[model samples]
Target: MDSQPPSTPPSQKHGQTGNHSRSHLTPEEQRRIEVNRLKAKAIREQREAEEAKRIPHPSPTRGTNIGTGVKRSFASMSSPQGPATLRDGRTGAIHTNRPLDSIRPARNFAKYVEYDFSKMTDTKGGFLTEDDDPYNKALYVRDGKKEQKPAHMTQKEWDRHQLLKSTRRDDIMVSGSKQNTCCECGSLEIDRKWEEAFGCCVCSSCKEKYPEKYSLLTKTEAKEDYLLTDPELKDEELLPRLEKPNPHKATWNNMMLFLRYQVEEYAFSAKKWGSPEALDAEFVKRESEKKRRREAKFRSKLQDLKKRTRVEAYRRNRNGPAGGNFGDDLGSGSRHVHQWGRAQENPEIGMDIKKCVDCGMEVEELEF
Candidate 1:
């Protein structure tokens, strides 16, 4: 190594070799590197374009520093050589200026101009003077004069004139009154016309005799009149014949009797058929039997569970206690020995005592 330092490779000697250093790579690797380089370059150019779109345009007029709050001439501000610009006083951001019309103009400009009251006159036809009225004084001006009715006219004349003026000619009738027939008594001399009560024409005598029956009798008489003039009958026949009762009005009992007869005559009917009530009772009985069976199954399951528990208890007792050192572990053994001694002494304690087959711990029996 002291004789000569290892010569650096041509590819490593110069850092500017770029793709030349990659010459040792396969053609596919070389192509992939070139594609990646082009993609990075395209991305950089796209970012530059987006930045350019975000940057604000420089003001055309001189002496205007876009984001600086400096007032400029009105002419320069209004000029459309480029978009007008303004500096936000608070935020310091440059924004495109709005036109004069975009801002709200002074409201009620005409209100400031004093009205000329010299040419105006009062209701008495006198000219208004500034000295006579204060500037803050309010003046109520009626638009026109109203014509007053003559006081010399008679009451009847006044009433007739008012009625004629208020009434429209189209609503007035000039013909004589026509005779109306009484709805109740069929009299042509109907003294009172009840227009609100279904437009009935009832004679005074009939109305006095039966006021409530007038409308009812009128409606019935109209219905009779309509029936008498039926289109199905000839004009020579003034009245129509009575119609039979509707068959659809038959009672439930009649329908049941008809159905019974039809079933008796039908060929495919069942030989032993019961009434609806009897059939309903039979269905109820079958459902009751099904419910009883379900209850019996539930009872059987409960009994079986109880029997299994009793058998488990008996087997546990027959197998003796659990744990190899049942009577040797002083801690648990002492407690069990005490319980066992007591059980032997008292028959009731034996009935209540139970022992675990695995742990040999004496536990009290659980009563269901």
Candidate 2:
């Protein structure tokens, strides 16, 4: 069978109700639709740009056409404006932030003008008088162009005006505090609270307190080695006045010390990462190895010294007994001393305490 062109919808072909309801559009409608879409897109772009600028950190670059299209579409879908309003059609009386729409009603409001003011008597501060005519005052109405106000006031006028009064000056006296001073160390006037917050100020004449966290000393009475405890100086005393040092000096010093301690202690804390921990761990390991070596050497030397002592004591005990001999008699012919075996014949041998003899006592040799 021969293939035929797909049948056009009856509705589309000659305005009949159809199986396929494809409809044709006029060029005018299509152009109108495109124009409306473009206008809507522009408005949406303006709103997005405004919102972006209001943010803390707006992107410096202008958005691409594609980005603008996306932003516009999203903004329109989310906003309360209707499609007709977006397409530049006459919008309904919808509440909005747009200035024109918000102020339109106010612009249409009838202004009050026919009221009489001549009957009004003078109130306090000369605000009004009975002879004054309200309409003749010529004050600008809301509908009229805004007029610039003049700024001119004499010194007396400003002084007389209660609204323009100068601020009252306050005379606040801050009493100086008595600081701790160490005459021997030449340290003076250290505030503990300030030191805890900022850092220690170590002046040659005065030692300011260091931060509690970063201090080398623990919390307790200050000692000579870690800290100097001095009598508190009275404010009235005429002692040497030291120059006021920067408060941040102690703070910075403590911070640096803290950083150093962190680096040193990071080896023990398992949470730290990177090269800081790695370097410190290696250093600690080496130090531990050195300590172990030193301890081992000390123990080895101690053992040797103990063994020598034991040997000397044994020799002394064996020789100190009755008839105890070192090994040989004074007139021995042989060089060897035989106190136990040949003492009767040779009479030169001395007791050997290192060996066990039949008597159960240690013998360097046998006693003569």
Candidate 3:
């Protein structure tokens, strides 16, 4: 069977046989029509070019279709409109945001007028009066020009507003700890950081004068040198640590800083270790304990080594074949016999134990 001829696509067919009336036109008519189309295109392009020149555009364009070179968002394209309220489609009630605004502006007053049966009607509840109004008088709503409270607030609300204002950080004194003179020397200026955090109103020179007290210690140093625990270090009230960003890692927990003297004081306090002498005693004890543990571990390792190693049986080769040591045999042509040691009573087994001098082998003999 023969295959049918390849079918042309609808788009291709439409394109090839476009406008049957136009296709039947003479060459002169077609030329005139094409000239008109070209003229129209030219005029459109000229108008667009003029518009582009008249309105300045940003550099590096978005598209030629838009006058503004920058891409315009959908929100920017729409006109700026104030908020408007319309009736809810589900309830057919006026929107809560603007109850009066939802109604269309008209000459009819009845459309805008709304009523609440609970307040306005004289049957169900009662006729509403000025006493039924929720809002109070708007007189004391403001204290001062800037301290003005929001409108329609109660006396209690206005009092709360003033109370909150009084407690503001700007109004309250943050720090009144003024000490101009240094505690150690008679210097006028003291170290800002030391006085603020460490409660030391001393100059940098005085801080250097007493290195043992004022010297800063790292968290690790404090723990190792002072023998303080994690819980003790974490106690802010007790230790009063100064936190700083970790120098090694930005993401890690902040590094805690403490004065050497403070750490020493806490470590040697009555609640802690009592005194430096007591701290020294504890330190020594820990060191001795650590040494003991090391020795025990070493001894254990040695025992393990002994257990893992295979012990060879003691064999004394005889001169029976004339290939053994001459002194190894007690007599010619014979294997050497084991020389036993003095007998010791083994009370647990009720046996007399004897060991050979050469091979270190033991023998157990029961006696009546």
How does model 2 score by TM-score? 0.17
lDDT of 2 by residue, 97-176 (tens): 34464443445465633435556664667554424654453533445464223234355654554232221111112232
Model 1 clash tally, residue pairs: 0
lDDT: the better of candidates 1 and 3: 3
Report the error of model 3 at residue 338, Å.
35
Residue-wise C-alpha lDDT for candidate 1, range 1-368, written one tens digit per residue: 45655675644546557767666789999799899999998887667655645665585454645567844444444445433455434444455454564554468663454455654545476555445544633443434562334444567866775676444233335332444457678775554214222345667787568744532322123233222122322221222122223345743221111111222222123322345455456557777999999999999999999998997577556555543334444332234433332222227554566544344556565457
Segments of candidate 3 deviating more than 4 angstroms: 1-180, 311-368
What is the lDDT for 210 in model 1? Answer: 72
Looking at model 2, which ten-residue stretch has the lowest summed lDDT?
Answer: 232-241
Models 1 onward score TM values of 0.17, 0.17, 0.38
Q: What TM-score quantifies how close candidate 1 is to the native fold? A: 0.17
- Single out the weakest 10-residue window by summed lDDT for candidate 1: 252-261
Please name the candidate that would achieve the greatest lDDT relative to the true structure.
3
